[model samples]
Target: MWMLVNANGYTLAPDGGNFSALVMDGGQIVAVGATDDVRLQYGARVDRVYDAQGATVLPGFVDSHLHLAWLGMQMNMLDLARATSAEDVLAQVRQRASTLPSGAWVLGANWDENRIANRRMPSIAQLDRAAGGRPVMLRRVCGHVVFGNRYAYEQAGLGIHPANPSDGHFGRTPSGDIDGYAYEGATTLLERGIPAMSGSELERSIAAAIDSALASGITGVHSEDVRHVGSLYRTMDIYHRLQAQGKRLRVHQLVGFDALEEYGEWLVEQANKQPTIEELDWLETGAVKLFADGSLGGRTAFLQHPYHDAPTTRGTAIYTQEELNHRVAQVRKFGLPVAIHAIGDGALEIVLDAIASVPAVAQRDRVIHAEVASEPLIRRMAALCDRMIVDVQPRFAASDLPWVEGRLGLQRMPYVCAWKSMLNAGLYLCGGSDAPVEPIQPLLGIHAAITRRLPGTSGDGRFMNEGLTPYEAVKLFTHGPSYAIHREDRKGTIQSGWMADLTIVDTDISNSQQLEMIPRTCVLQTIVGGEIVYDRLR
Candidate 1:
């Protein structure tokens, strides 16, 4: 039994109220009220009393989207996320290749051409020169495109005139020669040649990612790791083993579409049994994650019209509408909802139409990254509020606002990352970092939601009318996530019988000044199930 007192707290309960103290026992919030009242009832039996010193306390923040295994591996890769120019990226590659053994593959990630000085991708020759005879492959920030040197293609069994794969194409110069860039499915061709990590190495990376998330005050995450871990059983077994070490992050594991066969076998193995409350508290199966299209940054988001900047193409769709419909039906047989990634209007329309065709798939269906939309599409989605949830990355507005208007036209400005409009239309929104694509800090996401401006900038925030209030923005990581995972009754609040997951910050977020400085707000403690997982004070 433990008690937390002298705190400014928001319960976020059904009735909507506040509390000054919380009493927790056996991983549940047993009592919450005034400090005097709570102390009078449970102070005698409490084993410890934590003083918050009047800091703000709220439900633990949860990331509704992210790739755990990928983020872990990216942490160790050559980080080019902050490279300023094409030359800067090549310089880093050159530095990385110098330390590697001869012929070793030099890997890097997160290079954004939009942010670079020349606003261009490094050429194959530049990469070849930088790598100094070693093979090299670097992923764009969006993860939809990759740049490689000639050595990499040759090592992957592709000759100079290698044909494009059926699912995707390699970038070609005006003369129809390979340009060392791979789109979507073409990335698999190069990836197959890279060495796989051993089980111990993979587990270490997963553990590091989880600990990093916990340090950021993220007590839980909806993570997709089956594909990265290589199998459904391995993904589950890894999480189960991690939980045994006390104070682990809660994970809602999503199975990838590629693992459906293994998922079916695993489902049948446990068809007759029921999961215990403890089993759900640590880890549970989420929905099937399927990519409907690529990313906006790569101009492969399957837009309804050609991109304003690139008038030649409307972008690519990984699956045609008919294919997506069939896949959804296949997933329905397992009795689980589907979380579809639809970033552009074209992809969103196809996803919506597919769901409308099958009402069963609509129930608890999640539309991930519904980034581009028109008024009509918003209205159509509003009608399905009872059966759907839109998982959005709030920081996207902060990161994409500068170039979004150019990619989409000025006419499409109002519809770009219209989060406030979505909320007003009665749509349920869950927030996420989409880490490695964006930073995994919830406060940065909240700040982005409220400001809608790039960090360290001055002037009216872009699309100011579409910004959320402090409280509403906070809910994106709190109440909204609990509802998305179907654990609203047990996790989203600090009420009696609710899980004892609390995040303590040094500032009261209700204050506009404090909220505006959210990115600088210090997290004093992060507690999950009544156990302190992170303590800066300690």
Candidate 2:
């Protein structure tokens, strides 16, 4: 059945002017033109007609980097995103612990040491007392760091006496006693013991994530959660089942690098067992993800120089340049694309060198969270053009601005969220929420990109001098990201022969406004595959 959607204003393409109407049939956009012309062509055959009532309609947002299952799991956890003191964190932990059964793991997220009044990582003793002996583990906003109570550590079989840290570290005092904080590789101590979600539970969480995303105008996401090596098959089965059920969300799953090494043979075998690309239309396999460094919020991002506050420590890197190059070569040999998680300048340089080693023909390789890219690196990135992509989270700067400035100093902080610079340099940039770290709202992200201020910043309302225009910001979330994942031909823009994935907004977002008013710009309707998945009017 055909559908005719007439809106007062419609962005037919990222840069395309507003249109009055669009027509869709069999899940594809059949035509987009004047309202009267579209009506004259398909009005009789159309099964439904939607009146947008002067709202702005555009392509549904494409979030390039997110953890769908984890975001869903976070819906039930303690939210400490705005806690101003360590006491606030303990209080929230204590409250959650009081209601839970004995021995049940109490996990939480979004607590940052930088924001705490004491400016210290939470200790095991405090959490132990808060939990009254119940095991507790709290993840930092970046998800790269974790803090555990003594009972939680003991349950994971970690000893009080600290051992030599591996690629990542377990925080310790001068006396070599475990101090609750665990970074990167060390997070596995507690993560290994946490109960795994069942397939049904995973499905439910994914569905919840999908609904939440649709409500906020996100029709597609590139999820990068490759479960543990041993559970790869089970996780893949669950994903396959979800796809078979005709899940509303479009997903581009990137296989974890850990699985590539631990279960390489099995992964290759499974790849061979699966049908060719044509047969597996809903899923694409051949993208390997690697974490080259930790996150800035955790103060673990690899840096060429020491942090402004922590002068003695220069942060850390997971793989050396040579090692990364070898891995890149190996992945390319297998005809797979590589997506490296690199946040700091030093880390990005390492990844860039590895990318340069690969043949230029391999397109769509990306640097996830290319946050602090330098001028030279930006120039090199421009050379790659369509081949290199960036998955950026604009909201992070608004929330982390104060702390980031404090850590990097004012001179270096301006370069933290370099969206405008990247755009000017001709780099393909994709916008993502990095959910569980930030709320999954593309509108909020778009606002942050253009304004560089939180929703309620006082005074002149300028948080960062370097910011993007709304038109450019919209491209980052839509066409820019679509191009990154090689989906521009089918999605990203509203054109004839494209997928009918779109969002209708209540206001014209391109217009300048007070920072506070940005979040209230609700998505009135979200349509995917020619179906109205979410409609505020109804």
**Alpha-carbon lDDT, every model:** 0.87, 0.78
**Highest-scoring model, TM-score:** 1
Deviation in angstroms for 328 in model 2? 1.5
TM-score of each: 0.98, 0.93
Candidate 1's residue-wise lDDT over 54-102, tens digit each? 9999999999998888899998888988898888898999999999999
- TM-score (C-alpha) between model 2 and the true structure: 0.93
Best by lDDT: 1
> What are the RMSD figures for all models against the true structure?
1.4, 2.5
Over 4 Å off in model 1, which ranges?
361-363
Q: Residue-wise lDDT of candidate 2 within 205-267, one digit each (tens)?
A: 777777898889887787766653135565566667776775666677777876776446655
